[model samples]
Structures are given as structure tokens and as C-alpha cells.
Target: MHSLPDVSLRYGSLQVFHSLEEYKESGVCKIPGAVTLGKFDGVHIGHQKLIRKIMDFAHANSISSIVFAIEIQDRPILSHEERAVYLESLGVDILVECPFSREFMSMRAETFAREVLSETMHASYVCVGTDFGFGCRREGTASMLADLGRQYGFQVEIAAKERLFQEDVSSSRVRKALAKGDMKLANALLGRPYPVMGIVQHGRHLGTGIGVPTVNVHPGANKILPPDGVYASCTRLPDQTIRTGITNLGIRPTVGGKTRKAETTLFDFQADLYGQTIQTDLLDYLRPEHKFSSLDELKSQIGRDRESALAILPDECDRFYGGPAFEFHGQG
Candidate 1:
């Protein structure tokens, strides 16, 4: 198996691919030498290795790091904005998000190879995963692509599948791990912690009145949630500051609420965080979500939850909590 490349590309300062128009308008791929690549669903660690190879190959050969992928019609597990941001962070020079529809899906593998890969992308080289398949019933394989590369005058490089702890690593596997609250295994494969980002909204303010302030975040409807439970999480505020908090992900039982919502109460935080975008990374699972009859019951459980959460939080956070410098935002 060919060694997979390293994927430690810094994302803190890269331009993201948001639209096809933005990509074409940039004219970056119009350069004499340009390589094209795929849909890259999760842009997960394995995908990163492939992308890194493409980027490195492009740099060494003076080719544009053009990535061809389906943008719409194919529902993304991650929002386009989020996926684009992550890909950009991985240093993809040009990202072409094609609309993947029944029409595209029904096209012959030959047509996809010639029309999409050769004509539309004008790619000098194509990179793909060994198990990659395309067309109706997913007919195409790496060998077929290699055959096309021979006929179309472009090169094809297939990346070896990535593995972790002797097991193949994939988005599906990571998803399963997350569903089971296996954060360590998931993070080990993801190369970083999984974070849920969303804008904070106004809740009933019930927790605040009880001295347990909380931030309400409406996650992307389709976004996967860790089994409804309380988690020890780190919340990243817009200002890039991170705070430790205990987050409840489930229907509110104490106040007779029926909707399943995520409520995060930042310990020792007294800021109004309404309308702020924040991200939470679940570090540990505390317990399965449950229903309680009374406010007192819920409050008592929360108190215990806070104590447990604090024990799990980094020591530095405990020292900083309630300090004058630890100012929070939102309606105070």
C-alpha cells in the first residue's frame, strides 16, 4: 500500500470554497497545470491525507490544487459552509462543487470520466481513494479511473485507505463511535476533537434565575448528536476564548418542556451570550438524558452535574472561574 501523506495543514488562515461561481471566477484552475479531485464528504482525517498528497504533488509539479466535488443535490452530512471552511483550512487551492443530481448519477462512468473529469475540470491529474466508486450503482473503480487516465492523457493516483488501531478509519466508523460516546476513539481517528457550532439563542432563562446560567443553541437539524445526555464540553465563544461547561442535550423535563433542545450552562459564567456563535466539543459523557418531575429535582441534579463537570474540566478553568478577568457576554 502506498503510504498516505501527512495532513497537518494549518486551517486558521486559509480561504474556503463556498460556491462554484467563486471557484470559476477565481481562474486559479485555468492555469496551465491543474489537478482535480472529489466530493470528500467529511474531509475527515483519511480524506485529509489524500488532499495533502494532492497539494504536495501540485506544489512540486507547479499544478493548481484543484478539487472537484459535488456541491448540491447530494445532501451533505456537514453543512456546505462548514465543509468548505474545513477543506479550505486543509489548503485546497481550487474547489469545484458540481451539482450531483439524478442526471449526474445516471450518467455512464465513461461520460463522468470524460465530461466531468477531463472536459469540465481540464484536470492534469486526478486523485481518488482506492474504494471510490461512481455512476449509477457505483460502477467506476480506481482501476477504471486509471484506464480512463491512460485514454484521457491525465494521471490517476489512488490513495491507500487509512486505518486506526488496526481498524479502518472512516466517517461512518467515527459516527458510530460518537453515537456510542466513544470520544477517545473518535478523536483519535478524526485527528482532532469533534465540535458542534451554532448560534446561541434565547431560552426560557429558567436556569439563570436559579443561579445556573445556560446558553441555548439550536443545532443544525440534521446534525448528529451524541446520545441524548449530559456531557463535559468545552465551548468556544466567538472571541476565540474557550470555556468549560456542562451541556444538556435532550427535551427539558423539569419545566414540562417537550422539545428536545441542547442547553449549556457555563459554570461561573454570568454573560449574556444571545446571538453569539459558539462551538462545543464533547469531552466526556456524564450520563444519559433523563426526565425529572420537579424544579427542585432538576436543580439538585444540575448541582451535582456541575460538581462532576468541574471535576472533569481542566484545572486551569477552575482557577479562572469567577475571576474578575473572566467576563462573559450576553444580556447580563
Candidate 2:
């Protein structure tokens, strides 16, 4: 057996254990927690309900809150790092990125529940979606988990799947919306704008020549993205400043570019951002990417894109700066 190191890393206020074995070795397992497990690909509204249940239970019982995020896909709506940030923002106490290795894939459901959930993690309460499946070949269902919870001395809470537009909110649905470049529908399902994070890289500086300097960032292979198009975007700079911009996500065929990257031009902001990580959220789809005959044509179109982006972004900035307030009603 290949043993993983006893590693526990901290992200903001959340503690992350690479695997169940690492959690046991870190000695943090001594603290009983309300636990929830899922792939949580997009951390969509459906997943948020499960997380909220565990958070409420943990807070009421004065126990730690833990999330077991199973890694099962190569291209996820959000990268593992982005998921960790979202989980931390939701106030989860710990995150375990459990690798779905062959050993784990073949493990019996009952054994997983007993060894990992009951004994090792000391889960007092467990939450999952109604359609959740686990164990080898997905032989374990929500009902099976509930039965196991009874045997293992833990309570199980099954949250119903969230629906929007009479359709179930799922990671796959989010991906489809993005693939269609339906940013509005995608963001509505996500309960937030679709975000892309990457380190700004050096480019051909074509935008500079057109008098519209831009920053370039590659979204990476593991992160799924919308179609290649120009989008009205809101970017969070390294300094934590939010700037509205127009972002083009593609190979820049107009400039004879071959690399796929997100090239963004902030409306009224300019600073050297190379080597720094920035996050851009796609707010709305402006237009599909097109090859222009000349730099002047591209520049003129970019000016029009700026105007269109300005029209849609001011309201977004208002809401973003104001933030949202949540009122939690006690579970009856």
C-alpha cells in the first residue's frame, strides 16, 4: 500500500487533510464533527443546502464541521483549490479531499461508514443529498447511509435536491449552461457569477499596441470554461479590488494567438499584474469571438464591448459591494 504523508494544510480558517489517513494521523480526528461528503463539483445551490445542514448541526452541538469532497473528475466546474476557498467561506471547519483510488472504490459501503465516518472522524451527524450514492460501484444509496448511520450511532439528514426553472440544479447542468455560453442562466444556477482564477502570464502585448492594455491568465486544463467568447466580467485583483472589465476567453484568433487564455481589459484601471493571481467572474455573454480584418476593427469592436459591459456591470458592482445578508431561521 502506498501511504500518504500525515499532512494538514490550512486555508484561511479551514483545515484541510489530504485523505482519511492523514486526518487520523494529524490527531485532529479527536474532535467530533458534523460531517457531509460529496463530489461538490461546483459547490452549487444543491451542495450548499447539505453544507448548511451540517453547519447548523455542528454549531448547535458545539462540534466541528467537516466536508469530505470526493475527487472523481478531471474537469470540474471549480478546481480543488477554488472548492476549498468556497468551503472555507461557508465556514466549514475541515475539508478532506478524499481520493477515489482503487482501494476506496472497492471498499464496502458499511466498512467506509464505520471506519471512516464513525470511528476515525467521530461524526455525530451526517448530511447528504437524497440522490447520493457511495461505495464500490455506487452500491450505497441514501437509505443505505441512513441505515448505516443508525448502526454507527450518528444521525443522518438527507437534503432534497434544489431546483431552478423546474430543472434540478447540478454540476452537469452548470457545465451545459457554460458550454452554451449562457452566463445568465449559469450564474443564476450557481447563485453567483462563474469565476475563473489564474496567474497573469506574459503575452504578445497585442492589446497594448491597440491602446487597450490587458492582462492574460490561463484557466488551466482542470477548470472547465464557457465557450470562446467575449464576456462582461468583474475581476477581483490581488489587492482585493473589484474592477469591471471585458474579458475574451479563447485563443485570440484575431491576433494569430495559439494559446487558450482569458485576456481581460479593465475599463478604468491600469497596473502591472504579471505574475499575480487574479479572479474574473463572467457576468454576461457579450458576443462570440470573431476574427477582425485589422487592428482598428478589433479596437473599435472592443470599444463597443466596453460600452456594453459598462451598461451591465454597474448594477453588479452595487450588489457586490453591498454584499448579501443571510437570515438563518432555527430548524423547527
Candidate 3:
């Protein structure tokens, strides 16, 4: 196993390869390097720890840090585009996105270790979760990788498991939290706010008539919505400006609404956002969606929700959002 040193952690540049052939064509990852492999669905705290360790080792050893990951098509936490941006924020130099197909899934553990990690990635060191397993039918384990590292000439390190709320933090557990509308738990495990990106779409102008304007969004498919509720949100508009607001993720049960969507009441915000993409960082879970006896009653509740949104965000939201989400780590 190769030894490594300590270095200050900071994110630098990023390059992504959609295929192994494209990666080799770029003439990168052809020499010994530090690599971390995972699906990294949510890019949660546990995943961050592994990536940071690998990046640190790479920086210390004077080699490139590559993220060799599988892009799971079904029910993924973050899309490939979003995941690449997040990994770049963590200082990964190269991102090797492998298409998760039937043939790739059927590849044996030994073949993956020898062909992909050893030959293609030229991995000098590899870091993965304690429960890490891969290859045909989940036949590989952390110990199996460690043993193969000796044969293939690379070092293996199992990331220490992280815990919150007295349970192991994991992508599955995070999804469960979102299902239960526990934003604190979900966001805590994610190491950042739950990210939901969508394009602003037209909806019934019910709020406008009530004197409260809202932006309706059509979320990208497979985005897990949090239990149909009202939440405090940090929104990024298409012009690259950040705004704080309150959002409702529901079928609009109140006033006989239909279809699942998110409506945002951007505080002191006035703009033409129709047909533009907006990314919302849900910060705090407020209240669950409910049907009111009348539109006036619903309007009153929204007025109160608006006041609460103002108090939840930082005093200067514009400056706060200018930094990476990782800066807001720990229980607050």
C-alpha cells in the first residue's frame, strides 16, 4: 500500500468523461492516481467523507483525484449533471461516469478490479464506504477490494461510517427522511440543504388575486418531494442571483388543487421567471399541506408562512449563498 501525507483541502477544477474511451482519449487517468468509487446518490455526508479522504490523499501524494462512479438511471438522488457539479466543488479532477447497463452490471468482481480500477483508472489508492460492494450481483465487498488491491498493486481504505439521530447516515436513510418530511434529518445527512431543481411554469393565478404572488415550478422527474409541505427555501434564479422564499411542495390540496408541484412565494422578489430554470435549496420544514375551508383562509396562512420565512434565513442571504453549501455544515 502506498503511504500518503496531510494537505489543506480546497476544491479546484473538474473534467468529466461519459465513457472510458473518452477518458483515455483525453490522456488522463493513464498513470497512478487516487480514486473513489460509488454511486454517490445524494452526495450525503458519508459520501463527502470518502471523497474528501481520497482528495486529501491525492493532494498529498501529488496525483490526480478521480471519481469513478456509476450513474444509476432509476431513482437516483442527484442527476449526473448535478452530481458532477457537486464533485467538482469537492476538488475532484476527473469524473468518470460509467453507464450502468446490463452488461456492465454483469461484469465479475475480479474483472472490474483488474480492468476498470487497475488498468483504466490506474488507481494508486481507493476509498469507499465501509459497506462498499460492487460487481455482478453485488459479489464484491470492502474486504474483497482490499485483497484485490494487493494483487493489483493499490491501497484500499474503508471510510468510517457517519451517524446522526442515533442511526447510521446513508442515502437510503436520507430518502426515508424525505419521505417522512423530516428536513432536519434529511438535510443533516446530506451535509447541505435538499436540492430540488425545476423550470418555472405557469399555474392558476390564485395567489396573485389574493395579493401574494408565487412562482410555480415543474420539478425534474424522480425528484423526491418532501411529504407535501411548506418549507423555507433559498432559491437560485437563472440570472445567478440568490433569493430567499417560502415554498409549498404538494398537490395543492387547499382550494382543490391538482397535480404535484412546488409553488414559491419569493419574499420581496418581483421578476418574470416563467419558463426559466430555478433551483431551490429547501432549508427548513415548516408545515404540511392542508385543505382550507376557503381561499381567504389559505391566503391568511400563507401570509404567516411568509413572515416565518424571513426569520429562518440568514440576515444577509445574498452573501451567504455566494459560498459553497459545505460551509453551512453541523447542526444549527
Candidate 4:
């Protein structure tokens, strides 16, 4: 087994494991669980429904609720750290971030169920989507999983697809909405504002020069972002305080900068935030990023953006201010 030193981290009541080996090594596997497995890309409404099922089953049966998050090769809608935070907020007891190793991927579906799910994890029950697949080459189906569950002395629940506007709610759908800069539709599908989480990094101080001092964050390469634009945003600070802001997410073309970053100027706030991990929720798209004629022109547009952001952010703040307390574990 591949043993990693930083195998797990804790967030309040939630325990996160990097792999099945870590979970077994940590002895958390001794506690039987109601488990669900998925990529859980965005943890949107569809994913939430499946999670709720496992949580409820675990609670009723006096077992732990486990989410086996398969780490795939595709770029994620939410990064691993962000997904961990979201799962913690959702009250998951154990989140196993199972790496998609070639060896593990080649395991037979029956072997996976018998060894990993039954023998190792000690799952009392399992939940998954109706279209779930497993095993090498995606050969396992929901019915196959059910049969394996019976053989393995576990119960299986396959949740129906969650739909919105007569279409299935999925990570791909959310990505498409973001790609088009449709914050409204994306938020509607996600059942929350789209979030960008990162550490505050020092920038060129251009915003300060223009009298708008901003906090800059580089979204990682794998994180999918909305089309480069100005957005009405709500930022949650290190102290768990939420502040309204105007976020410009793009390569600063007028400044001749090439890196894509989110530079947010928080309204009515003036505390240094360098190196702090913060979550900025994009509420509404204001406008596409534009290169202005001069610094003065850029500053004027930012002034207008702040006003527009303020107008749009109050209601958003009211909605999400006290909803969930997100803690950054320095995983990013």
C-alpha cells in the first residue's frame, strides 16, 4: 500500500482521508458506515440528494456517513480543498479522497465491492446515482452494484437523477453555465452562489494606485472559472466575516499582465489580507473584462462596478451571511 504522511486532515467534526489506505491505517474503518461514492464535482443539488440519503441512513443505523470521492483526471468544478470544505459543511463524517491509480482502476468490480467496500470500509449500506458505473472500463452498472451488495451483505440505494428546468442537474451543466458567464443560472443549479477559494497573494498594487486597493488570488490551473469578467461578489474573510466586493476575474490586459486571477476590491473594508485563504462567491456577472484607454478610465469603470456590486450584493449577503461557517485547512 502507498503510505502518505499527510494522509488526513480534520475540519471541526469532519474527518478527511486522502485514500482508502489512509482510512484503514487511521482505524476509522473500524466504524461501519453508510457510504456513497462519486467524483462529486460541484456537490450540486444532484450530489446533495445522494449525500443526504447516506447521511440519513448512517444516522438511523448508528454508523458513520462516508463519501468516497474518486479523484479523476478531469479538471474539477471545485478543487479538492474546496470540495472538502463543502462536504464538511454538509455534515459528512468521513470524506475519503480516493486517488484514481491505474492499479486501483484495474481492479474488478466484484473485488472492489468485496475488498474495499465490504472488508475494508465495513459499509452497512451504500448509496449512488441511478447511472453509476464502476470497475475497469466502466463495466459495472447500478444493477451490478446491487447484486454485488447482496453478495457482500450490504444494502444499496440508487437515487434518481435530479433535474432542473426539465434537464438533469450535473457538474457538466454547471460548467457550461459558468463558461457562458451565466451566474444566475449557475447559482440556481448549484443552489448557492458559485465560489472561488484561494490564498490572498500580493499583487502589483495597481488597485491601490487607483485608490481601490484589491486582494488578488490565483485560481489554480484545474479550477474552472466563469468567463473573464467583473462580478458582484461576497467574500468571506479569515474571521468568518462576509463582505461585499467587486471582483475582476481575468488577465489584466490594460496593465499588460498575463496571469488569470481574481482581484477583488472589498467595499467598506480596509484590513490587510495577504496570505489568508478566503472564499469569494460570485453573485452576478457585471460585465466582460475590457481594456480601457488609461488608468483613469479603468478607475472610473471600477467606481461604477463598486456601485453596481453594492446594489446587487445586499440581498445576497442577507441570504448567505450566516448560513455556513467555512474553515480553511491550508490544503490549497
Candidate 5:
């Protein structure tokens, strides 16, 4: 398993407020802005549409654009780091990550409006999905929010939910797609390849003994991984270099692997990446995970997986790896 160092993280130029008090300490509550509230698990295309609408409205009104994101009760679809990076790239001026503790979850509908919507953030307009809810036992509805806005002197705007391929797009839908090894559909829903960010950890040097080398990454508990399989993927190095690679997300049965991990072997690169943070973007699925009878057979199969991956992926590594293509696709 990988270990993450305890440290404060930043998202490009955008400031992240981890708590309401922290936001108040930053003196941002004084700034009038249009706000959106949600858990924002994946920040997928559906989320993009909602955020863009709020941003456009705020811009037209010459006010700030803020996203009041809440912590998810379940395991998060994307790591906090990945979400922050994507939100900043989407042109959000501020990200208020409200803690979803027991006390906050028990707050009443009216109190949420007064404490968070009116006094704390000082929002002029509030935007949300048609199904959005808040406060104690989800007693707050979009309609209730609009009425509350009227009482608090703010406007409420509700954006229609997004539908993709006759089915509504959602973080849970993306996860279901990944669970079935459908990276293509998942990519379309997310507007980018699936990315998992983590520090490179030490592993049994089975690859090297078999004449190939790889870096092993252990995703955090909250980060959801695609179904176990061999994938055509790309890696972003700490130096910002994009490297073409083949990744495997599964337990190496032949090598006696016990835990599921993301293992990647880059083409034409030989360097030590242990302890360095890296992002591996899975572009396409090549094959299902299998149990090999021997190391020789496993090595031969890997050679085939690499060739198949190269045939399916772009020849120029930077074309889709770390360049502009990854901007809104959640590679950062």
C-alpha cells in the first residue's frame, strides 16, 4: 500500500477552503458571488454543465463564482486532489469544501440558508440541479431552496440534469461502467480518460526479473478503480514528462500478488520513481485480468499486451498524455 504524506495541498491558482471557519478566515465571505452546492464526487460533464452555467451567470452579473462542495458520506469517486485540480481548471473562482460531519448533516433547512447561504457565503444567486437537496434529513428541495432564497433575498437557479446515451450521467453511473470494464463509455461520461493519482510504491520486482520494469501505485481507499484488467495507459512524471505505457490493475496471480494495485511499465524509459507522485490515465481496455501458469507465459503475454496497446493508442505520447487533451478530461 502507498502512504501519503500529511500536507496542505493547493489547486493551481485557486484557493481551497477546507472549512467554513477557514473560508471566513480568508475574508472571502465578504465577496458577493453566485454559488452552487453539491457533493461533486467526480466533477464529470454533468457537473461541468452546472458549473459553467453558474460561472456564466456570475460573469454576466460581474460577481464571483463559487462552488460549495460537500464531503461525500460514501467513498469519494475522485480523490480530493483530483477534484480540486479539475474544479480549478473549470474556472471556478473559489472552492468551499464543507465538512460533512454529523453536526452539519443534522442542520435544518432554514438554518442552512441563513448560516451558509446568506451570512457565511453572502451569495447573490444560488445554482443547483433539479434534484438538489440539503439540511436535516434532506428536507430541503430545489423548490424549498427557491422559497428560502426569496426569504433571504437571493435568487435560485436550477439546471436540468444531463442525459448521456438515453441514460442520465452521474458519478454512480461512471462507477458502474468502470465496474463492468467499459472504459470507453466511462470516458465519454467523464469527458476524459479515467485517471488515478498516487505515490509510486515499492513492489516485488517481478517485471524486472521477467525483463520488463514497472512502477506500482496504491490508490487511496476513496479512489475507485476500473475493473481489473490490462489497459492502454499513459503516465505523468513529476518532471511533467508524459510517458506512454501499459497498465495492469489487478492482483498478479503468477507473481503471488495479494493486493490489487495499479502497475505500469513505460516504453523507452528507465528511471527510479519510488516515492514520487504520479498520475496514470487509462485510455482503453485491452483485455481481462488472467492467471498465468508460469512467469515465461506471463512475460510473453505482456509483450503482446504492449503491442496491442501501442496499436490502439496515439503514436505521439504528448498528444493525449499531459497536453491540452487532458485539460478538461481530469488528467491533472
Candidate 6:
């Protein structure tokens, strides 16, 4: 078991109500208003601004602030847990994370307003972006939500849409930036570096022979991989310490000719990390993967790569040592 928190009662600065029973159970609970926060991928600067408005509105109205986020939605770029973490960090009093099912997706706009917003979440207010849409092929527009709010005796706050450099800030834009390996723009829009998580898996130990040992990681199939190339990245170990590494995120044409593998050559680190989870953030692209004629040539190229990585990396490289070399041959 993951040993996670309670499914029903989620702790928050804002009292999180799950179902109608939970809402009705807590009677006379400070006007019982809530706002529907969306997928909120990256928790970008624009998202932060809108959330702040929602918090301020709820506070000024003397109502318990509720931020309703969905789980397993059709378009979620981040997990429900990740979204909850970011919201709680920003002082979201209550967070309602409900499974987005077929029933919920097919519900009428009015029913969604009544069941989700009013009955379940006990929302007296709803805040959404100007481009927000919902319910049955996305029939619930901001205008519909506003109308529903009036009908349900609640207020709807429409947050003005935001843009970065004259382009609307959106998850699609962020994905595009990441796809192009434009980390600077992506970070600027995201307000933090984008990252990928994977578990350390054992690989044919080719690095030790070259005097540079590496840990192999296969990123979760669902987790999007950045553009293929050698990247200067930071690895966050299970122990919570960050280490610098050079990552190759492409088909290993040199050694593993048939199967491509994503490998991280950690600098100055030596620990048994197999089966442990690792988070890596790409800082800069170093070079394209090149095939070498022989082991000596490959090692020479890797040495140069290490030097380049060290120079680009902020701190001194760790002179880490690990297990002995194992042979791996490319079956071309």
C-alpha cells in the first residue's frame, strides 16, 4: 500500500469537503463556498495569480475557502496528489479531489453545478479562468457557469486569462516549449524547472569500463520524455539530496544497438540506487549522441562530455565510484 492520507477527509488550510454527506455533516460551516480550480499543470505563475484571487475572495467573504481539483481527468498533465501538494503549499484551505469518471463527464451542466459544486463541494462561489469549459463535450462555458451560479444562489468569479510574451499561457504552450528543449522559456512560464521521475534499473555496466559509472533509469511510460540528446541535469535521490548528472535520452546507438535506453551518468556519487526512484531536471542540452569506433574512442568522448558537464553545472562534480565494469556489446 502507498500509505497515503485519508480518502474522505483531506487536511487543508481550507476545510476540504468530499461528498454531500460531508458537506451537510458540517452544518453552518462559514457560508460554505468553493471555487473550481482546473488541471493547474506546472502550477505556473499565472495559476498562482488566479489562486491568490480565489483565496482573497473567499477570505473577504468570510467563507471557508475551497479549491476543487479533479483527479484522473481527461487532460491532466500532473497527478492529483501533485496538484494537491502545490495547492496546499499556496495555502488552499480545502481541496476537493474527486475522480473524474464517465458519469461526471456526461453530466449536464446544471447537474454538475448542483451535484459537484453545490451538493458535494458545498460551493457558494466558483472561480475559473476565462477559457474554462466543462460538462458533456465541454458544454459548460464560463457564461453557463455564471448563469448556473446565479441560479444556484452562488457567485462566479471569472479570472482574466493570462499570457506570457503576448502568447496565452497554457499547458499546451508549456508542452511545446518542453518538446523543443526550450527549458528557459518553459521555466519562465512554469516558475520552476520541469522534471521527470523514474526508478533506477540495472543495466549492462558499460560505464565502469570507461571509468565513468552510470545508473540506468526507464522513465514511466506515461511520463513524457524531453527531446532526445545529452542534457545537463540534476538528479534528486530518494534520500532527497540533489546530484548533478549527464543524461542521454535517446536510442543508445553505440552500445545497445537494438534497444534504446535512457541513462544517467551521475557525477561524484556512489550508492546502491537500484529500485529507488529518481527525479531529474534537465538544465541544458550538451550534445547529440554520437557513435564511436571503439571503447577507447567512446571513453575519450565521455571524458570530454564530463568536462563540459562540469563546467556547465554550477557546483563541483562529485568524484563518485561504484561497481566494476560489465561488458555490453551492440548487436548490429
- Which candidate's lDDT is highest? 4
Candidate 5 Cα outliers beyond 4 Å, as residue runs:
1-9, 60-62, 315-332
Model 2 lDDT, residue 307, Cα: 88
Quote the lDDT for 28 in model 5.
Answer: 73
Tell me the whole-model lDDT of each prediction, alpha carbons only: 0.68, 0.84, 0.78, 0.85, 0.82, 0.66
Instruction: Using TM-score as the measure, name the better of candidate 5 and candidate 6.
Output: 5
In model 3, which range of ten residues has the least summed lDDT? 1-10
Give the per-residue lDDT digits (tens) of candidate 3, residues 120-224: 889999998888889999899999999999999999998779888788888899888888888777878887777776668888888888988899886657766
Error of 5 at 94 (Å): 2.3
Q: Which residue pairs collide, candidate 4?
A: none
Candidate with the larger TM-score of 3 and 4: 4
Q: Number of clashes in every candidate structure?
A: 4, 0, 0, 0, 0, 8
Off by over 4 Å in 1: 1-39, 61-63, 71-77, 311-332
Instruction: Give candidate 2's TM-score.
Output: 0.91
lDDT digits (tens) for residues 1-332 of candidate 2: 11111112335788988887899999999999999999888988888888899999999999999999998855899876667766776789999888889999999899989998999999999999989998888999999999999999999988888999999999889989989999888888887778887778999888998899999998867789999999988777755556778999999998898988999998777789898777788998999999999999999999999888888776665543334432111111
How far is 194's C-alpha from truth in model 3 (Å)?
0.4
lDDT of model 1 at position 238? 59
| Residue pairs in candidate 3 whose N, alpha carbon or C atoms collide under 3 angstroms | none
Q: Which residue pairs does candidate 5 place in steric collision?
A: none
Per-residue lDDT tens digits of candidate 1, residues 49-125?
87787788888888677766665443344555455555665667666666666687798888878876676566777
Overall local distance difference test of candidate 6? 0.66
Cand. 4 TM to true fold: 0.91
Q: How far is 261's C-alpha from truth in model 5 (Å)?
A: 1.4
Q: Is candidate 1 or candidate 5 better by TM-score?
A: 5
CA shift of 322, model 6, Å: 30
